[model samples]
Target chain A: MAVVTSRRGRRTAAPYAFLAPAVLLFSLFILLPVGYTAYLSLRKVQVKGLGLGRGARSEVFAGLENYQRAIADSQLWSGALRVLLYGLLLLPIMLGLALLFALLLDRPRVGLRRFSRISIFMPYAVPAVIASMLWGFLYLPAMSPLNYVLDKLGLPEPNLLSPGSVLFSIVNIAVWGGVGFNMIILYTSLRAISPEIYESARIDGCSELQIALRIKIPLLIPAIVMTTVFSLIVTVQVFSEPLTVRSLTTSVTSTWTPLMKVYRDAFAADDLYSAAATSILLAAITLVLSFGFLRFVQRRAFGEDR
Target chain B: MTSTPARRPRPAFLPTAILLIGAVYCLLPVAWVVAASTKAGSTLFTSFTFAPSGSFFDNMGDLSDYGGGIYWRWMINTALYAGLGAALSAGLSGLSGYTLAKYRFTGRSVIFNVLLAGVLVPGIVLAIPQYLMLAKVGLTNTYWSVLLPSIVSPYGIYLARIYAAAAVPDTVVEAARVDGASEFRIFRTVALPMMVPGMITVFLVQFVAIWNNFLLPFIMLADDKKFPVTLGLYTLLNRGATEPALYSLVITGALLSMIPLVAVFLALQRYWRVDLLSGAVKA
Candidate 1:
């Protein structure tokens, strides 16, 4: 009985032991940071007696002051609006190109399928920083081939880094970096679909475009939703691309996006309290958007998930 | 002219053209860099963009000779961070995934759900608190500050769990259990081998992620010696804003930094499965 009890106990405890490392790491990194952020967001340093000596400034509970300030901060609102505009421009075009390329590659008798797939997916290997840098140079009018060609043709050279169009330039870099990965995911999901479905659709005298539009896309709704949510989550936290491109241009401000604002607050302005509050808000927005979007799509796609 | 009547001619032209266009669009910048990296700083702006110059070796020499060979240090640091971080992360994911997939225990669902939720939390949100916490502990500038946080990947665990469930059969584990083998022993000797393909996928994903990651190291390490290639290159680019001469070195560094990752991706192209990423199995 002792041996049997010990054996069963060991078996039960084995899983926890196996999972201990991940649980510990996750707690220390993800849970701890989030909890710390929450704690910091609610606390403010009260400067006592000119704030010159130790203990002169002490952390005190601010009772939603930081949150209120963050909400009222026009810079944060502008940053959020900028990210929204970025997503608005980035999503449809990126996903559209991804879907188009995916469908084209999935088509029967497609030429250079391997080359196209590998070439398109190659950018996934390049870091966003590098991708932006490369595109940054290409957008520089002095060295840009686009401007060079335009100038040679006696046409006006449009400034890509101008404040009015820098957003579009940033959008182009993201599309270049992103379309490939999204295309791969969508394409992989497409390949999971059995060929017999397509065969029947073909036998019914439907053209390839009809099959693609009517059958392939409808079945791809789940995968599309997944990619869209992933992209949305990523877009909400747009940091490195604009940050990197900011080196070459003046349009992308120090607070061009919400996360950038958080970064500036935390690092540049040394306002950890406000940065913590803004980041918490950003995290909340991300969770709400992703979950809300997922639930919304799930309901529509599966007819109320019954 | 000799095509069979029963087979309808597929208009492969448009699809081919469209895919080729994508390929060209994707490859264009890379091609430009390959050409641009060859030009000298004096002529980089003066010359046509695509025109290659003979200063390629000179530019590479300058990149190497810049800042007492610090560029190579960044390269080595990137390799170490990515290689070690990914390996550790893959191992943890494998173990946790196997445990979650093979066994049901107390708080299992809750644990899995919490970790899955970690996937949606933006890095910047966590990055700030992580920095603060590490700062409190005097570890903010250490290598551990970056490597420690990178090892716990919720998406990796999710993928590993799916892979473990699909790949490892209950009977094999049961058979090993019937032989009086310990759980860890069986995992090490039997289950781990079966999970190799999935683990490789996890490793490559984590590898690319840590390699390409800038924000964590950017926030963590202030030491130039500890900077990864991404941060190092960014600093170089920032300096290039003032000294245009450094642009050649920055361009060369960017090109050089990409080679390892592109090589790794291509070599492991077969195992780099997106099907597993989205929880789909090819039919």
Candidate 2:
């Protein structure tokens, strides 16, 4: 009995020893940072007369003041609202196109499938900053072929970077960079379905479109759910595109997105306490929104995964 | 499978048309950058948008000459950060994942759950606190500031675990153990080879994530010499708004930044079999 127990202990111990490095690194880099941010969010900086010297400033505990302020800030709320609109525009169009392309690629008769897949997935390799830079140049009136064509056709050239059109421009960039990767993900899952499933449908005299609508779409619910959640998380943290676009036009303000506001407050304005608080708020909203979406979807449709 | 009435074959027009439209949308910006990079200063706005010009080499010379070739420094810095960071991340993930998959351990589920939770934390919230902690250690604005934080990727570890579970078998480990090999030896000689394909996938994913990352470097470093191409082009664009002549350099630099990634994607596509959904399904 002693020998057997010792051997069992040894077997269990090896895995933990190997996992120690990953556990330690995750604790230091990820876990600790999250805890530290939450802690910092509850504090405030107190400045004494004229704020002249080092001793004049001190940290004080200000429970929920920062949260209230963040909640009340019109700019931050509007930024969140703007992102909601952007997500509404982006999620359905991008995911719809991805599913369509994936289904098309799965069909046997489609020509240039490989070329289209690679070309579409090519943008995922490009960084968001570079993507925005490239798209930004194309948006420039003097540098755009669309504007040149409009001039030739005697039509008014619409400004893509203007206040009214900047959101759509940003959404277009996000969709272009994202759609292909999602398509590949869905396509891989689609390929994994046994061919016999589709063959039986064909033997029963079902058209390809009918087979896809009934079988393929129902089978792709899990992939769609996963992609939707991931896209939601990414869209909430929409910082790089707007930040890059800010460099191109004055229409983008210092506080264009919630994360960008946090950056500006912390780095540009030197308001670390408020920035920390705002970031905590943003993080909370993201957690609630993502998990909420997951719960809702799981309850309604993706019941098997949970 | 449901049965339906037979129908005539539709022309391969609608799907082809929609896909071509998307491809053109994706390609338009890239095409514009390539065409715009050829024009000389001020000709960027003055000439026809897509017309070819003769100043491509001259613009490259001008970008190289700008600020003592700081653009090249940015490029090298990006390569260092992405290359070294991804390599270290892949190594760590491989070891940890193999252990988790093959060995039956106490607290294994707890550790994995914690790591998965790390995935849900948005990166910005982590960046601010990480900067503060690094600053306390007097390591801010240094290479380690970016490299150290990037080494521990939750998603990489998660993928590695999935790969190891699917690819490696416990029977092989027992065979090696019976042959008097140490645990590390078995891992190195027996397990590592089996895990290569998975490690390569992790490496590519981490490489792209780190290379394309902007927020970490944005907050970690302030010096222009330490800037990655993403941040460098950002500053260039900011200044371009003031000096229209800088547009050509920005366009040229954007085109140049894309070459390495395109080469990597084309070369590495074979190893990029991602089964993230399958893992989720199994769990």
Candidate 3:
């Protein structure tokens, strides 16, 4: 593969040249949007003199007024708290099920392992909007086969779309869509662990459950943390599911999630400045939460050995 | 090899039963979509949810005729966005990742970290600002608006860097440099073939991502002509709420959308290094 044998002729401009496309794209798309969002967060439009003619509303720096409004916004807080609950509901069961499935698949005698793994992971391919739409139809009483079966069996129908239960409805879709990816991550990591470790546990008279409890789960901490952090990031940005499901049912508000609020404020309500502030604030909270999780894991993982 | 006979006899039924239950739960909606799409508009809700009718072809015909076959146009638009976007993203990620991995340059770590931080920023939050910025340049409502933002994939770059470090050995690069091959030639020729598998991995990852992207295209495009399938189906589903007749079409469209993606997922099952999810991309 190596034809050239002389290193002296290498140019200093090479690496930068290679990186120019990424640098340009990163600056234009990623960095610029962030900076623009931050810049918009601090400014508001001033309307004066009946606000009718040219220059009636002038854009001007508000110096954190939008931020103050965002901080006090009740809808934003409810949305945050709602997501907090949703995240709590989602992360544990999703990860726990994922861990369970991964462990089950790793076991020696698990049947239909390949089929179950593929079927479980298949939803990862279904986009969130599509997944929600599919589930939305199923949640509709008239359209739902589950409801049909229940009625045939003389069972009571529960409203999954009620205001009280709608959040859990959303969480179910998330778990359904998310479990497979997490399962695969856990399964992959589990596969990479040396079988010799399991052999030793077996030789020490450890049962399968005992070995799993004492060895596999403990060794899976790093992978589990990774999945948790990723889940945290994805859940906070939840948009498509609720947004799509809202159309089928009137129960979902425009500000269902914080991202939904950002969308509603920006487009629906025509309040770009407030939306900017809200998004920036949401972004900050997300950063803090993710970084805090990382730090918590790091402290426990590293500090204990000392 | 047995040191002890302490482990209980393997009970296959319990594990198999649990997994099958999970599988059924996972596949239920999918089965419904397939079953629902087969019913005629009149018979859709009137029939069993899983019962098949002879209207599958008829529903496809209606979806095709609706908006003068705009559904197919959405499918085409989706292909363009996901395919072209992922291709460009893979190219940029490959080049940038290769540079970051192989070269010792000033400010490299800083630049890489800055890009890495891009992954943490909720991309959906940036959609509005991106929309406004593109509006300034009169670029929103265009294909470039959706395609452009997607090309800068921080995660792809991170994955690509890992792939490059593993696939392209430094010794080969040094030998090529010593042989007086131009750096671009070494990269384009010697190193690129080695990076193809990695590039394809990035391509597949970015492909699914861009395929699933709803917010970017939702905010960017105002024209139905430019809508991806996700947004297209969204618009259809919104209309379907009032027009129950359109439910069959929406259901049909939803089923169709999964076909391409599921095919890809199944065919490339082996290539998906979920280790990317585990933050162990250093391979």
iRMS (Å) per candidate:
4.1, 4.4, 5.5
Tens-place lDDT digits, model 1, residues B26-95: 9999999999999999999998999999999999999998889999999999998999999999999999
Tens digits of per-residue lDDT for model 3 on B107-204? 67677778777778888667988899899999999999999899999989978887787779999988987787889999889888888877887888
Query: How close to the true structure is residue A2 of candidate 3, measured as C-alpha lDDT?
Result: 33
DockQ scores of the candidates = 0.60, 0.49, 0.53
Q: Comparing candidate 2 with candidate 3, which one achieves the higher lDDT?
A: 3
Highest TM-score model number: 1
Candidate 3 docking classification: medium
Candidate 1 positional error at A216, Å: 0.8
lDDT values for all models: 0.89, 0.84, 0.85
Residues A1-306, candidate 3, lDDT per residue (tens digit)?
A: 232323443455677788888889888887888899999999999999999999899999999999999889899999999999999999999999999999988876677778899999889889999999999988888878888889899999877787888899999999999999899889988887889999987888998899888999999888888789889999888899999999888889989889999998999899999999998888888898788554553354224322
Model 3 regions more than 4 Å off: A1-10, A292-306, B1-11, B279-283
Top candidate, metric lDDT: 1
Clashing residue pairs, backbone N/CA/C < 3 A, model 1: none
Model 2: pairs clashing at backbone N, Cα or C within 3 Å: none
Arrange candidates, best lDDT first: 1, 3, 2
Most DockQ-accurate candidate: 1
Measured against the true structure, the TM-scores of the candidates, in listed sequence, are 0.95, 0.94, 0.94
